[model samples]
Target: MPAHDLGPTDPAVTVPEITASVPTGPPPAWAVLQRRLFDELDGAWRTFRDRYTEPDGRLRFRGTIDDRDGADDFYEAFFNWPALYRLGGADDLLPAVKLHWEAVTRQLTELGLFHHEFERGYDWFHQGEALLMFYGICAADPADQRFRERAIRFAEQYLPQSPTGNYAPRIKAIRAPHNGSDGPRPGLGPQWDDRFGGEQSTMRPYGLPLHDVPGVAEWNDLADEELAVRMGHHMRDRLGRGDTAVNLAVTALVVNAWLYDHDPRLASWVREYVDAWRERSHAAGAMPDNVGLSGTVGEYHDGRWFGGHYGWTWPHGVHSVGAAALVGAISAGIVEGDADRLDLARRPLDQVWEQRRTGLPSDPEATRRPGWAHTLGPGDGPPVNTLPTRLGLDGWFDHQPAQVAYWTWLWWFGMRQEDRARLEALRDHSGYDWTVVHAFRDKEEAGHEPPWLAYLDGVNPDYPEQALRMALAQVAHRTALMAADEKGADGKRTHETGADDGLDLHKWQRLNPVVTEVLTQLTTGAPQTLYNGGLPLARVRYDDLDAARPGLPPDVAALVEHLDANGTTVELVNLGSSRTRRLRLLAGGFGEHLITTVHWNAAGGAYPGDSRDHHLPAGDEVARSAPVQDNTIHLTLPPGRRIRIRLDMRLNARQFAHHTSPTTSRRP
Candidate 1:
């Protein structure tokens, strides 16, 4: 309660007067680019909406994805639309987002892929992707009863002793890897298609889930029907039922629900589930990628824990496991307010680092080498550090530079000297220039953390301009891609229907031109929220007082220049030629952080030198201190005026929620 102790009701604290610094020069390049990005995103959203959806915001596809599971793909396409809306995209975006979610849920339910507006049964990897849109919807409009109901409903399906049977309270783990409203699915083999029982062709790229299926030693051998059947049976028996590490992502969904109402059960579930995995990781000497129905580390794979569905062996390896661990760890930390919960993610990261190999591989050009395809810097640079990416029966393999995402999230959450030290060490050893901005986009639509971190550390002064330019380039590229899509009767691209090749599955993300990564990092003093499933956590957020909505006001741009243990320095620039703007700055994405004081510089004689209140005159400039009420500070910006605000902040000092004034009672 001390975080909010300097309440307005307290007579001792004085309300500070704020004045903007009127500058007489051309607007900064970053400010112009920020407004341009928003404008570009506005046009891009219109094109996407008109091209893909019907009048009611439903996609124009005629049927479900045949022979393959793709409910997640449909949702992921527009998952970040609500995030754009929250970022001041357009007023129409919020309603359109809701419409798309409703239409997609209805369509998926009709396809038998959903029950109770949630995934029927699917791996958490895909489910996490699917739920991103849902989470965005909730965050954008927490006051909506529909989203509130769905949040609690969707999370309850994962609770211990729930009728869904997705979890077992006795084991303190999810009952199976593939689970949701319809409970754990019975088999891994496809139920929708008769040919091959599932499209083996779609999965052929990953080779066999289990290659040693009696007479099947190579991927080509699986072409024989009998061998393929044997392989399917092997997968069904071993991976059809069990708790895999990727299920840890479900903690975010539960935590999302808790943020709405602060339900004890939801928070309790996150703590128990993450702690259960932590105990298992400790016992196994590393985070085991799989745990069986009986809570055994390797109940189904002949006492081997690395080969389960979406686990450590077949496909993505530690990429999947590490991301899940990080999600779970962060979610637990949110509910428990314990930074130590990060150890759930840290232990595996450290273990992987321990297996790291320095210098170049003997066969540097070999595609099959351990450190083949990872981004370790320029091709002609010094040898970068490499860590194991996948753990198989053969031991550590698929080496690459330590993933920046894991280290970025860890540092953001931990915010400790050791975390900073580790992050800096990784950056130094990454073989990449931390100051260069690359236009490459990953699955999360983010891969520029190196430059962003450098900017935060003051090593990359031009990062804001470079990153924003790159973001603009990304928008332009995706716009061209959208233009190239097959046009429909309406002259817009038509949605591909009933195809299982998955070429068109990612059409949304590929063509989605809304790039918020730069804006979020530069303005809110936070990295892009974990793309798969992460609650928005930031040092600061803004609401447009004039428009009465979240995000920066129109024609206004903000940049957080520096962040430290107890404060953040930001500059708010008004780009409009006229019409003063009013904005409210909130400390934290959901009003979780506490703002102890606000320091701003005013022109000469802006305040009286004899004032006994917070405003004090210091030579030419007047320095002011403001008492923040309910985690908010109001600013009025006149045209052509730019103000630098230095906010003293207490990070994560209170319970988080969507509204500035949260009524939900938290258990802490």
Candidate 2:
């Protein structure tokens, strides 16, 4: 009567092989609450090293994660790797990062970019997404000669001086520099030429509004000028233009990554794109998911926004959150940039905050899906599965939580006071990381069938199976579509809808590939996910390991705090009129953090670069972070009496099973 293997490892169910030594120990309660983030990061690297590779350094993937074969896989993997050496000193991920970098280049065709279908030559958005991801990971550790070299190498290729790419010759082309599989047509050179329906992608691919925006008017009247200048116009006719979650989100990643490496051009290009979109946001008040190229909105007679997988709906909002976050992150007073960019990015966040003041961020007005409508709830909350966020952003087509969380977490940094507090309460990524991993691991360890199966059957009303099923079904549908090949009447690649909600082999592809792509998933079997923000969570602490910075002066309050890629970011607020010369932070209970070296975030320009020994009349600069003999970090308050610090973690001895005194009974 049950659906199927609701348990772990049913011979009947097919799942991508996950091969890693699942550390099975009922670790001490204190230990259980602490994550060796570095350890888990290392384990993840080892997992990749052990499971995803061949002896010859060839990475393999046939629709499974660690496939590392396509642009999507590359970006996802890069997003997760290199914690120690880059931020601390493990250096373990450096070699693997370098090898993957070289292998990715092999996928590059004449377009000088990477995508799922190598033969297709290029997927402009993903090309930049992966490039930026690679650059971020590699540059995290400037001391790594190989990482620095590889980062530079990728920069040269991606931001080529040669005019043989799909990128616009100007400063603000969203299309990546890519060409078709056959290189170029007989007469045209390497640049993308005017052609339709070959491998050329359409620009202004934003989430389209399904309904009309009444007051919004298309303001830009410069198409005639754009045509004359001839920059970034896809060889197609364009009366209207807009952006998508894929383009804007990945563009944010590109801009930030470029800044990480100190490149002003790519960052400037990203600023230009945001500037265009910001103008539209200003006109409309509400930032539509997409807009015209001339930095105008409400243009298309059809709708206010454009349409795609990230169509002016859930996916659009999900993707847009990333770009929004960067606006604030850059304005976090960390970088010297105009405050306007932060405000532009925060436009949507401000909306979310207003909605939070009223109800949830979810559009109560949404008819199709209420869940997907909410951009992000809280980290303590479930994965934001109001609906599935698609990734046609990747050429082959897939979805994953890491992408969702990456955007969400970064956006968390941008949240204003009320919003940041709400977001911080849910910091552990309950939906994606904690909820899913908890259900999977707890049940598996107890030797029960998949616990979620009972929940799906309506037996366990309290379990968060809906979110889990949404994620699982996503992967299942993708895998089903992968195995089943559909061809249209004319033999173009197509897909079908299965009765069981799985991807079937015979349906006519929808006119909009994005629509068909969405249909296949809502209609498919057990889903798949390449990487989960929650997957590593089993190894992470379910409990808040470190309490609020203890022993703060009565006048000082721990204002805002969360872990960045390298360490903990704490912003101390001074509520009292008088300034405390020094605030001693009780740094215990953090799993491995008690031993990390401390540095003023403001002192260090960026992350890894900031992790170096600090000695500017602040805390003592250890050559490397170590186990603290005393569990407190002393800090000198700045002129404003407010300060932010980075407690950068470094690798030490393997973490013991019991970090705290043993009498604490284990409970997650």
The C-alpha RMSD in Å for every predicted model, in order, reads: 5.5, 19.2
Worst 10 residues of 1 by lDDT: 1-10
Global fold similarity of model 1 (TM-score): 0.89
Instruction: State each model's CA lDDT, in order.
Output: 0.75, 0.32
lDDT of 2 at 630: 26
Each model's number of backbone clashes?
0, 37
Clashes of 2: 37
- Model 1: lDDT equals 0.75
Model 2 TM-score on a 0 to 1 scale = 0.43
Write model 1 residue lDDT over 28-112, tens digit each, in one string: 9999998899899888888877877778767666665543277887787787777777777788888888999999888888777
The sequence of per-residue lDDT tens digits that candidate 2 reaches over residues 518-628 is 111111111111121111111111111121111233333342134433444444444333443343343312221232455442332222225465632333222222233
Candidate 2: where is the Cα deviation over 4 Å?
A: 1-47, 61-70, 74-78, 84-91, 107-133, 144-245, 250-267, 291-303, 306-317, 320-340, 350-415, 421-668
Give the poorly placed runs of model 1, Cα more than 4 Å off. 1-17, 22-24, 191-207, 359-382, 486-503, 605-620, 627-630, 660-668
Error of 1 at 623 (Å): 3.4
- Tell me the lDDT of model 2 at 479: 35
